[model samples]
Target: MSFQHTDSIALSELEGRAPTHSDLESRGITSSKEKDFKEDVKETVADSPVDSDVLIRDGVQRKLGQRHIQMYIAGTIGTGLFLGSGGALHTAGPLGALLAYVIVGTVTYSMICSLGEMTSFAPISGTFPHYAARWVDPALGFAVGWNFWYQSVTSIPTEITAATILLTFWDENINNQKIYTAVICVAVISINIFGVRIFCSTAEFIFSIIKILLIIALLIAGLIIDLGGGPSGERIGFRYWRNPGPFNRAGLVESNIATDQFLAFVQIFVQAAFSFGGMEAIAIAASETESPRRNVAKAIGRVFWRILIFYVFGILMIGMLVAYDDPALLTDTGNAAQSPFVIAMDRAGVKVFPHIINAAVFTSAFSAGNTTLYSSSRILYGLALRGQAPRFLTYCTKKGLPLFAVLISSSFAFLSFMRVSKGSEGVFEWLVNIVTIGSLISWLTINVTFLFFRRGMIAQGIDMRKNVYHNRYQPWLALWGVLWLSMFILVNGYAVFFQWNTTDFLVAYINIPIFAALYFGYKIIMRTKIWKPHEMDLITGIPSIEETELPREPPHTIGGKIAAVLF
Candidate 1:
């Protein structure tokens, strides 16, 4: 595997004195792969690193460009934000839910900052897990990689369910939701199987642009409704917050109102985490992106705006437009009708726009599902490259699509059809719980992994901000993420204890033991050691001196400048 991105140290573009054998020994950079890679960098994450004498093309294609990276990150703005946020609002009230999202958004942004720093330097498909193996513990990598893959598999169905649920807005009487699920599933799988080039450049980019436009439109429309721009001309200005009183006590109310409301707020963290779940796919996309060193950093740096416009503003608007206690929010129809945006429109005597919003949401669900499938397949391929998954999973088509990996990942999405027997809304809740647990786990692991990455870089005398992307708050920002994420992960399943529901408990916390088993089991069986900071493999993926090219120029045209700043 030959990595294509040029690093400041590894690339010949920046002239500097090369480190001598004695200089390297003094720094304790003892990895044999690190030393050997200086002469011949085997870099692509598409397959195992091979000998330079007889190298092959990386299995995955680098087709995604800056535009694709921008929209792909925006793709997570789907069912969770548009539809599921109503549930979060219902559970946590207006202010409570608003605060929950804001808190989760902060931690998520920190993780993205840390992720951007490394990906700009060593952009790879497996992403955080691969970083873990090189910078922290190999056992942690094995466990986290599989955990992340499971998270990806489960995410596909959650989005599928969201799409099927949205279809009920058109025909609530259709009982065979399984048909809708299967149809949606086929559409998503087909787009992915079409190959990464068409998948990202065409279908994926279109999906992202549509979602972004719709989100902006919704934000504007929501603000208007809040200010009495509707047919009814009713200014609902925080009236719901006054009457409902900004806190919804959970069903686990064996305690006082404050405790129950606290539990309710705690539960919303899970929902919000689910809403912000797919940020890591940005780093995952780095391996397949054209010029990841430049484009991936640009995409990640723009995350603050994405979260502000897509989540924080949207949450505030939802809270102000609709009352948390509205019966419509908890509806069993599990479609667009329960959506706060739809509810706000309906209450404001707005007729046609609900359908329009519902259609946008329908598109959002499909786009999110497509992203989940693509990320999952690539993750499996990454695992195969590391010898964690089966070798057959690494096989790719001539166009560089991971064929077997796509098929296997698509198979897991069939779980969406389980709603045929379980019912749509119930199944949606169950799957959301499961997926949220997986997402929180993945985020916490990424933060911890970044901490280790930072220590290794510092110990090896690598400069964080010298020609490399980095946050000044650094290890502190990552620490903040670790602290909060761990708290949420622990408290997520606490409500189940009050209610004593076996299913909820299992769905909410089962990943913990499974993750522990995988981590410790791999450690004991493989006899892997926790890598020290100086011993980490930081240079393997960096470009060798021979691989550097002329530096990229600044954007000259208006269009190019717009893309440079926004995408």
Candidate 2:
């Protein structure tokens, strides 16, 4: 799977320089030349193993395992189920929220498969964006990489803000959210700066404890309350749904409920997507795994059940255990003091549970933010390796950490405090909206890239049957993902643009225009044109599956074995 640094047909040979749109038009390079230029760029770019090599260091150290992947996925599942559910319930009503989650979850499940298949085959530090450039089009690669980077950067602050807000429930006198956010951001940065294994191990431990404890506590409390043994007295199963008529008091078409509900559902889809955002982070780390192909395949295969159990079941529990119509649950304060989980626990007669849940929620938010920092830094490092960013970002410390990238990524969280200082939440809201849009765009690009990658594989006579992981109905799945995501962008984005009362439409929807500008601007400046199948990097020829295999490890010493058993 190693790429030869030198090739017979260099990028310069295809285009006197990197072909710009003007150059393509003036040189009269027909569709054929355009395709050739794209292919050449892709092949040349793909030929280097610079980023992957640095990430794995010749595949010597293998730290991530099944547990790490499992917890990593759980970490991404988030406290959204615990806290964010109330908002969804209010917007869509009980049934609407349930259906909305199901719909979005289905799409997410499919997307995870598509991503899993790609990473299982061509595990790399850059992950999907690199594949987009190599297999689809260079413009697409550029768009996705930057879009994801932007999403990751902006998302850090929101997570931190959530952590700070949650902390306030314990002590109202803690006024310095910015200071706390800064401190947490620094701590996460330090963890990531230590290396991927340390970062992942910390994430695994934190997320596993938080997720398991929360779910267990909720299950136990729900059972106790349902069995008529709680402080609140007898069972309340499905009583809330019945009284609420399984829908919000405000109908979908009603001014406050209809428009708001529909829009809120759309926004929640984005939020759900973002909450599941770092699932792909598992694949990004797969390149460094001992057995990337097998492990990634196993991880992706379990995505459906994981989402069902952790997300679907968890939300269903929330809906059943707590009244959707509770005013406390419906509050849109977006402050931590008003967490639905905390309120739900209080109402369910669980003494001291709110504090415990708040602490876990804070840890979960911190974990989410910390993981985003790691993901963003790696993405930046990948971009640098491809010459898309400053080369300095590609440099790794002795511990294999992207120090500069971590610093840059972590700094974005500081901007979260702008909402408090500016007296207008416009900037913060705009950033959140942009993160949504950017993430959607990245997802769309990944699907599109997968479609092209599948085609290139087939054309090159690569047998899909041989792959342990395969994305069924490739072109169809990819096309559907693209279409649905486009609808999300347009339908959701149009509101931002046309809604006259909205203050940050320009900032919120800016990612679309910015992406278009980058694509066309790069095309015009570099004369880059669309590519065809033959001109695609078509790394389907490389046997990455064979190249990546699990390394053997020595048996644990007695002390290690005892620790393993106890732990």
Number of the predicted model whose lDDT against the real structure is largest: 1
> Model 1: per-residue lDDT, tens digit, 298-409?
7877888888888999999999998888889988566778788888888988888778888888988898898889888887887777667887887888788889999999
Q: Could you tell me the lDDT of residue 203 within candidate 2?
A: 63
Quantify all predictions' global Cα lDDT against the true fold.
0.77, 0.66
Candidate 1: residue 80 Cα off by (Å): 0.8
Model 2 spans > 4 angstroms off:
1-63, 223-229, 249-252, 255-267, 332-337, 419-425, 473-476, 493-499, 502-504, 540-543, 551-567
Where is model 1 poorest over a 10-residue stretch in terms of lDDT?
Answer: 46-55
**Model 2: number of backbone collisions:** 9
Q: Clashes in model 1: which pairs?
A: 1-42, 1-43, 1-44, 1-49, 2-43, 2-44, 3-43, 3-44
Residue range with the least summed lDDT across 10 consecutive positions in model 2? 1-10
